[model samples]
Target: MPEKFVVVGAGPVGSLAALYAAVRGYHVELYELRPDLRDPATTPLNFTKSINLAISERGVNSLRQTGLTTLVKDVVSSTTPMKGRMLHLRKQGKYVREAQLYDARGKNLLALDRTSLNKTLLDALESMPNVKLFFHHKVVGVDFNKKLAWFERRTPSDPSSRGTEIEISFDFMIGADGAHSAVRYHLMKFTPVAYQQEYIDKLWCQFHVAPSPKDGKYRLPPNYLHIWPQDEAMFIALPNQDQTFTSTLFLTRQGFSDLDAHPDRLVAYFQDKFPAVVPDLIPADELVKQYNENPHLPLITIKCTPYHFSSSGVIVGDAAHAMVPFYGQGMNAGLEDVRVLFDFLDQYPTDRAKALDQYSKVRTPDAHTINDLALRNYREMASDVKSPLYLLRKKIEETLDVYFPGLGFATQYSRVTFSNMPYSEVQRRAAWQARVLNCAVGGLGVGVLGAMWVWGRGGGWARVKRGVLLGCCWIARGVVGVVRGWE
Candidate 1:
C-alpha cells in the first residue's frame, strides 16, 4: 500500500481534499505555492475584491457527508439565506424587483465570504495530525512514475530577497493545483489526458456598498441579495458579516473599454441607471477609480480527463474541472468532488486503484455539463430573462399556478435550483415540458375562438360545455405525452 500521499495547492478545495484523505487514514502532505495565508502579516493575493459565494443543496449535502456539518456551520454562521433569485428590471428610469423562488415553499441557498470559508477549512486541516502543510513551495514538476515533486521554497531573506530550490517525493500524489497545474502537465505524459481550455471575454471588477450604520449592526435588511440589471451590463451585491455589501460589476470587453476611456463617467452611468445604489452606498470617486484601475480578468474554464498519476494518485477541484463563476458552484463543486471521492473509496474498500479510476470517469461528465450550464446562465441572469418573451412565459406559468399549485415550482429555474436533478437532465425535462405546455395552450386558444364564433349565434349551454370538455381533453393528451417521455 502507498504510505505517503502529497496534495498540491492549499486553497479551500485542495485543503478539503487533504483533510478527507487524512481522515481516511492517508498520511498527507499539502504543498501551497503561496506563503501561509493564516499568517496575519503575509500580504494577500490580489485575487478579487472579496467576493461572496452561494451554496445550494448539492454543495451542502456533500459537505455534510464528511460529518463536518458543525465545522462548516461555524464558519458559515453569518451567511444570509437567499430564497431565490431577486431579478432586477429596469424600465424608463426606474428599477423594478421580482422574486423568483427556487422551491415551492421558498427553500433558500446560502451566501457568504469566500475568505472566511477558506480560512475555516485551512484551520481544520492544520488541526489534523496526518496533514502537514508546506507553504511558499512552488511546484515546478511532477514525476508520476517515480512519485516525485519539484519546488522552489520562497522566504524573504532580508526585506528584498527570497529562498531556494526544494524537492519532495511521496508514495502517492493529487493534482489539485488548479487550471495551469504542473502535476496535470506531467501526468498527461503517461495518461492520454484529454484537455480543453476556453477563455471567456467577459471581464469583472468588484466594489463594495456599505450598510447603513446606526449604533453598529447592519442597517439594510441583510436577507436578500441586491442586483442592478441593465441587460448588457449588470451589478450584483451580497451582504457580508461586517454590515458591508460586496458587489461585482460584470461587463463585456467592449463595455469595459468604454468605461476605461471615460473613467469619470461610471458614476454618471450608475446615477442614471442604478441611482438607488450609488452616492450613498459607494461614493462616485471611489467607484470610478476601481472601474478604470482594477485589472479585469477573463473568466476561463479548464477540463481534463483521467485525472490521476498511474494507479497511485488523483486530482480534484479546479485542476480537474475549472468552471466559470457565474453559477456560484465552482468551489462548491470542488468541495463536492472530495465527498464523492471518499464515498467511492469506502465502497471499493479493497480496490483503491479501481476506485480512483472510476471516480475520474463518473465526475468528469457532470463537470462538463455544469461548466456549459454556468456560462449559459450568465445570459439568462444578465439579458434573456429581461426580455418580453421571457416575462410572458413566466406570466403564463404563474397564471397556471393559480389553479395548478405545483406547476410554477416545476419551472426550469426551480428544477435547476430547488430540485436535486442532474443539470443536463433538468434542461432536457424543462424543454420537454415547454413543448407540452405550448401544444396545450395552442389547442385551448383555437378551441376557445371556435366556440366563441359558434356561440355568437346563441348556441345551447350544453354545446358550450361540450366545446370546453373537448378543449380540456386535448390539453390532457398533451400532458400525458410529456409524462410518458420522462418515464
Candidate 2:
C-alpha cells in the first residue's frame, strides 16, 4: 500500500510535490486557498511585473528527472537567448545601451510566465488518478500530533466568508504553502524551530511592455533580459511567450514614498530618466496610475531550522527558506528541493523518519547559502551589470573559458542560474576562482609595466605587449589542449 499524503498549497512547489508523490503511487490530496486557477476567471496574477521567472539548468534537469519535461515544455517557450544583460541608461533625451553576457560561452537563462508554469503543472496533476485537488479551501491549522488538518470553507468568489472550521486526516503531510506557512506555524507548537523573517526595505512595482505595434513582435531584443541601472534604484524586464516583456522597478522605502507623494510627477520622471522605454511601452498616465494603485511590495527573506516535524510532516520550498527573487532561484530551488527530497524518500522507503531528518540536514545549508548569495546578487544586477570594467572582466573570463574548457569555475550568478552544483561547494570554488582572477590581473598588470619600462629604451612596449599576448595564448592553448586531450 502506498503512503497516503496531504500536500498543502497548490502553487508551483506544492503542485510539484504532489505530482511526484502521486506518480510514485502515493494517494495525494492537495489543498489550496485560492480558486481552481484553471478557470480564466481566476484572473491569474493580474497585470503584474512578477510575470515570468527565469528557468535554467537546475529547474529543467529536476523536472526531467521526474519524466515530466515534455509536458511542461509544451506550455512554455524560451526567449531568443540573451548573451548578456542589456543595460538602459538615460543620457540627454535618449537612453544609452550596454550589454553583459551571463555565460562565458554566451548561453543564457529562459523566462516564462509564472502562472503558465503553475497551470501546466496543475493540468498534469489533474490528469493523474492518485492526485486530488481541494481549491478555494484555506488551511487554518495543522495538528501533527493527530495527523489532521483544519480548514475553513471558502468559495472561488469572496473566499473569506469566514466559515466554521473542518478537519481532514492524512498519513503524512507536506507543506509548501510559502513564507507565511500555517504548517510551519503549527509545527512550532510541538517543537521549537528558530525563525527569522526580514522585510528588505527595497520594494518592487511591476509593469509590462506590450508586444510591439509592428506585427506584435518584440521592440527590444526578445532574447535579452533588459535592465535600467540607476544607482540606488533599478528596473528590469524579462520576455514572455506572448511577445511581451514584464518589467519590474525596485526602489527603496523612501523612493516609493516619494512616488506616492508626487504621483503626478511620475511622467516627468519617466520622461527625464527612462525616455527610451517609457514612450515605447506604458503611457505616462497609465504608468503613474499603476504606481499609485499597484503594490509597492517589499521583498521578504525567511530562514528557519528543522524544516520537518519528526514523523508526520515537513516544510519545503519557500516555507523552509523564503528568499527575495533577485537571484531568480526561489522557484528553481524549490523545485530542486522537491526532487532531492523525493530521491531521498525513495532511497530510504521504509525508514521514512530517517528520510525527513536527512532532508532537513542536507537541504538547510544549501537553502541558507543560496539565500545569502541571492541577496548579494542584487548589487551585481542593479549596478555591476552596467559597468564597463565588469563587462571587460566578463569578456576576459569568456575568453579563458573558451580556451580552458570545463577546467573552470562559475560566476556566482552562473553557479546558481546555470548549474546545480552544491551551494556550499559552489561558494567555496567561486571564492578561490576570484582570488585566481585577482592574481592574474595583478600579474598581467606588473608584466605590462615591466615590458613598458623595457620599451622606453626603444621598442620595449611593443615587445612587452607581444610577450603578454603570447604568454596568455600559450597558457590558454596548452592548458586547454592538455585538458581536452585528457578528456
Candidate 3:
C-alpha cells in the first residue's frame, strides 16, 4: 500500500502539495478550516484582504513542475500582465505618471486573484483519484511519533456550534496553513522549534477602482501596477480580469485610527497625498464606503526553524515563514516551497526522514532571506522609488547588466523576481554587485579629479585629455576584471 499523506490547509500551497503527493502515488487527504472557496458563499479567512497577487517566475516554475500544463496555460490566460510599476504623483501642481519597468529584459509579472488561483489548484486536485479534500475541519492536535493528527470538524450549517473530533493516521503531514497555523502551533509541542513572529506597525485596507462607466474599460492603464508612494504610506493597485483594479492602502496603525476617527478627512487626505486616485479613479463616496466596510488588517512576519518533525510532519508556505506582502513574494515563496520540498523527497525516496531533514536545513536560510528582503522592500516601495539616488543606482545597475552580460550583472529586483535562483544566493550576489558598482564609480571619480588637478597645474590640454581617457579605460577594465574574478 502507498504511504498515506495528510495535508493541512487547502490553500494554494497545500493544494499544490497534495497534488504533488497524489501524482507520486500517495493517498492524500487535504483538510481546511474554512468551507471550500469554490462555493461563492464561502467567506475567505480574515488574515488578509483579497489583494490581487503577482505571479512571477518562481510561482510559474512551481506550477510547471506539477506537470499540469493545461492548468498552467489556463492560469496564464486568466491573468493580466504587469510589465512595470506606474507611479502616480503631482509635479508642478499637476498630476503626472511615471513608469518604471521591473526588468531591463522586458519580463513581466502576471496579476492574479488569489481566490481564482486557489480554485484552479483545488479543481486540479479534485480530479485526481487518490486525492480527497475535507473542508470545515480544523487541525486540533498532532502526534509525530504515532504519525497521527486530530481535527475538530465543525457543522457547515452552524459553524458556531460545537462539533466532534476526528483522529487520522497518516504516514506524513504537510502544513501550508497561514500565519496563525494551527498545525504550526501543535508542531511546536513535538520538537524544539525556534519560532519568531512580528506584527509590523502597518495595516492594510482594500479598495476597488471600477472600470470606466463611459467605455467599461479600465480607468487606469491595465498593463502596470499603479503606485502612489508617500513617505510613510502607500496606495497600490493591481489589474484584475474584470477590467477593475484591486487596490490597497497601507498605513501605520495610528494613521488608520486617525482616519477612522475623522472619516470625512479621508477624501482630503487622498487628494493631498494621492491626488490621482480621488474622484477620477474611485468616487469619493464609493472610496469611503469601501474603506468603512473593509477591515484594516495588520501585516505579520514569521520565522521558524526546524520546519519538520522527523519523518512524520513538515511545514511549508506561511506556516514556515510568513512575510510582509511588499515584495509580492508571499504566495510565490510559499508555492516555491512545495517544489523545493518535493525535490528533496524525490532525491531520497527510500528515506523520507532524511529528505525532510535536508530540506529543512537548506530551505530555512532561503525562507529567512526572502522574509528580510520583503520587509526591506516596504521602504523601497513606500519612499525610495521616488529618490533620485535610488533611481540613479538602478539605472547604473541596469546599464551594467546590459553592457556586461558576461559579468553576471543583474539588478536585485530582476534576480529576485525574474529568476528562480536561491533567495540567499540572490541576496549575496546583489550585495556584492552593489559594492562593485560603488567602487567602480569611486574609481572613476578619483580619475576625473586627478585629471582636473593636472589641468589646473598647467599640464597641456592634450596630456590632461589623455589622462582622463586613460583613467576611464582603467576603471572599466578594473570593473570587468573584478566581476569576472567573482564569477
Candidate 4:
C-alpha cells in the first residue's frame, strides 16, 4: 500500500504539497479550516481587496516542478507584466513620474491575481484521483511518533454546532498552515523547535482604482508597478486583469489611528504627498470611504528552526518562515520550500528522516535571510527608493549589467526576482556590490574636496567651484570609459 500523506491547510502551499505527494502515488488528504473558496457561499479570504501578486522566476520555477503545465499556463495567461516601477515623485513643487526598469535585459515580473492563482491550483488538485480535499476540517492536534493527527470537522448544514473530532493516521504529514499555524503549535510538542514571531509597526490597508469611465481603460500605466514613496509611509498599486488596480497604503499603526480620527485628513494627505492620487487614479470620496471601511492589517515576520519532526512530519511555507510582503517573495518562498523539501526526499527516498534533517540544516539560513531581506525592502519601498544614493547604486549595477553582458554582473533585484539562486547568496552579492559602490563614491567625494581645498587656496570660491565640477565630470568620464571598455 502507498503511504498516506496528510497535509494541513488547503491554501496554495498545502494544495501544491498535496498535489506533489499525490503525483508520487501517496494517498493524500488535504485539510483546511475554511470552506472551499470556489464555493458560492464561501467568501474569498481577502474580501477587503483582491491583492495582486508579482510572480517571478522563483515562483514560476516551483510551479514548473509540479508537472502541471496546463495549470501553470492558465495562471500565467491571466497575468499582466510589470516591467518596472513608475515612481511618482515631487520635483520643484510639482509631481513627475519616472520609470525605473527592473532589468535592462527585458526581464519583467508578472502581476497575478492571488485568488485566481489559488483557484487554479485547487482546481488542478480536485481533478487528481489520489488527492482528497477536506474543506472545513481544522487540524486540532498531532502526534508525530504515533503518526496520528486530530481534526475537527464542520458540516455545512450545522453551522453553529460544535464540530466532531476525527483522528486520522498518516505515514507523513506536511504543515503549510500560515503564521498562526496550529500544525506548528502541535508539532512543537514532539520537537524542540526554535520559533520567533514579530509584528512590525507597519499596518497595511487596501484600496482600489477603478478603470477610467471615459474609455473604460486603465487610469495609470498598466505595464509598471506604481509607487508613491513617502518617508513615513508608502502607497503602491499593481495592475489587474480587468484594467483596475489593486492599491495598498502601508503606514505605521499611529498613522492609521490618526487618519482614522480625522477621515477628511486622508484625502488632503494624499493630495499633498501624492498630488496625482486624488481625482486622478482614485476619487476623493472613494479614497476616504475605503480607508474607513477596509481593515488595517498588521504586517508580521516569523522565523523558526527544525522545520521537521524526524520522518513523520514537516512544516513548509509560512509555517516555517512568514515574511512581510514588501519584497513580494512570501508566496514564492513558500512554494520553493515545497520544491526543496521534496528534492531532499527524492534524494534520500528510503531514509526520509535523514532527508528531513538535511532539509532543516540547509533551508533554515536561506529562510531567515529572506525574512530579513523582506524587512529591509519595506524600508526601501517606503523611503530609500527615491533617494539619490539608492538610484545611483542601481544605475551603477544596471550599467555594468547592460555593458558587461557575460561578466556575471547583476542587480540584487534581478538576482532575487529573475533567478533561482539562493536568497543568502543574493544577499551576499548585494552587500559586496554596495561596498564597492561606497568605495567608488567615497573616493570621488574625497577627490572633489581635495581639489576644492587646493584650488581655493589662491583661486577663490568661483575657481574652486569650477574645479570641483570638473572633478565630478572627470569621474563620470572614467565610469563611461569603463562601460565602453566592457563593450
Best candidate according to lDDT: 3
**C-alpha lDDT of all candidate models, in order:** 0.74, 0.78, 0.90, 0.86
* Residue-level lDDT tens digits of model 2 in 255-342: 8888778877777776665657667777677687777777778789999988888789999998999999888889889989999999
lDDT tens readout by residue for model 4, 176-280:
988899999988999999989999999988998999999999999999999999978899999998999999998889998998898768889899877699989
After superposition, the stretches of candidate 1 with alpha carbons farther than 4 Å from their true spots are 46-50, 156-163, 213-220, 387-409, 418-420, 449-470, 485-487
Off by over 4 Å in 3: 45-48, 461-484
List the candidates ranked by TM-score, beginning with the highest: 3, 4, 2, 1
Error of 3 at 108 (Å): 0.9
Model 2: worst 10 consecutive residues (lDDT sum): 478-487
Provide the TM-score for each candidate, comma-separated: 0.88, 0.89, 0.96, 0.91
> Candidate 1, after superposition: displacement of residue 112 in Å?
1.3
Query: Model 3: per-residue lDDT, tens digit, 238-309?
Result: 999899999999999999999999998999999999977889999999989999998898899999999998
What does the lDDT come to for candidate 2?
Answer: 0.78
Clashing pairs in 2: 84-100, 84-101, 455-460, 455-461
| Model 4 lDDT, residue 258, Cα | 90
